[model samples]
Target: MTFENAVLKLVSGQINRVSQPATLRTEEKAVAGEAASQTPFSEEALFEYHLYTLENPATLKNNQAKQISLMSADSVPIEKKLIYDSSRNEINSIFHQFQSV
Candidate 1:
């Protein structure tokens, strides 16, 4: 509560805030380097199927694709998003039962 203590706290917070970005960047680089060091091939290089699998030009279903579509925008590649055709359509009614919970 004293002015000296308050000023020291503020300075400490500011120093931490300034260094936080560098700390985060360093941590990210460290993890990436560690992961890279273990493997002769990265995901892009090792897994040709993951990198080069062809997707259908046409979107088959609207409702089921929503979550997959949104999450697909992120850098992480999802394997489950690649789906085959199915004619079933009870999801809206099935999903409605869980609304109260």
Candidate 2:
């Protein structure tokens, strides 16, 4: 898959880095909801983790950080959960789940 005008962000164990801004272009299409007579076509933006090869080597200096974007999605469905274990402790944990279409 090729992405145009796509921004990338690198995330590792405790360190995060932002890659250079690029362009992304896709030919993928999505079908809209049922209409009275005709069906309309809409552009859907799909974001996924992908490996990208850099044209040139990038270097980072100490204490220097760069900002990069990983992915962007619209109208994403999310579920939030709160759990408490009386046997374990009195601490409550919060969990968030994101569903991708």
Candidate 3:
């Protein structure tokens, strides 16, 4: 199988002819503290999700791992967020946010 310039979030697999969820590897980088510096008074902020696309067709093999390069941009905008989830033991989580353009 091969994919070219595809934004695939979920992929399917077959196990004993039964359809199942397939695993995919992804790499992402975001710059934090950029948005926080702009809006310090906001309690919650929205950020963009980075979309990665292949420059060429990537071939996939069964039970074999392959590394491919996605799109690379210089100085991509990002936001840093601190989330407090009450449902998950009241522990705070820090994550970089990205919005898809």
Candidate 4:
């Protein structure tokens, strides 16, 4: 199964399991209330959850660059240096896999 389908299946399965109880309720209102209280999941909400961003893109980039800089120290000077540079094309290539066809 695809990643999204797998995730939805896991989540929905959990919800389904939690929703059904072994003990039965006597009151009709109580049963109705319990059913009404259950949360309904939507595709939009699931997609948004997957796409949610915690930090600004610029801030994330800055933090990544800072982390890379922190890994290197002035005392540890080397003759040869290795750099990892990413271009727009590379970023697009990575992101393109998730885009809808």
Best by lDDT: 3
Candidate 1 residue 75 C-alpha distance from true site, Å: 23
CA lDDT, every prediction? 0.30, 0.42, 0.44, 0.29
Clashes of each: 0, 10, 7, 0
**Model 2 lDDT per residue over 1-101, tens place:** 33444333332332354975443223111211212113122222335433333323345555656443232345756789889889988658897765434
RMSD of each: 23.2, 15.0, 15.3, 23.6
TM-scores, in order shown? 0.18, 0.31, 0.25, 0.15
Q: How many backbone clashes does candidate 2 have?
A: 10
Q: Ten-residue segment with the worst summed lDDT in candidate 1?
A: 4-13
**Superposed model 4: Cα runs more than 4 Å off:** 5-26, 42-101
* 25: Cα error in model 1, Å: 0.7
Residue runs of model 2 more than 4 Å from their true location after superposition = 1-62, 90-94, 99-101
What residue pairs clash in candidate 2, if any at all? Answer: 3-24, 4-23, 4-24, 4-25, 5-22, 5-23, 5-24, 6-22, 18-67, 18-68
Better of 2 and 3 by lDDT: 3
Off by over 4 Å in 1: 1-24, 40-101
- The superposed Cα distance between candidate 4 and the true structure at residue 7, in angstroms, equals 9.3
Residue-by-residue lDDT tens digits, candidate 3, 58-91: 4565555775432244455678987888788674
Tens digits of per-residue lDDT for model 1 on 33-91?
A: 55444433323333323232212233334343321121111232223332333466333
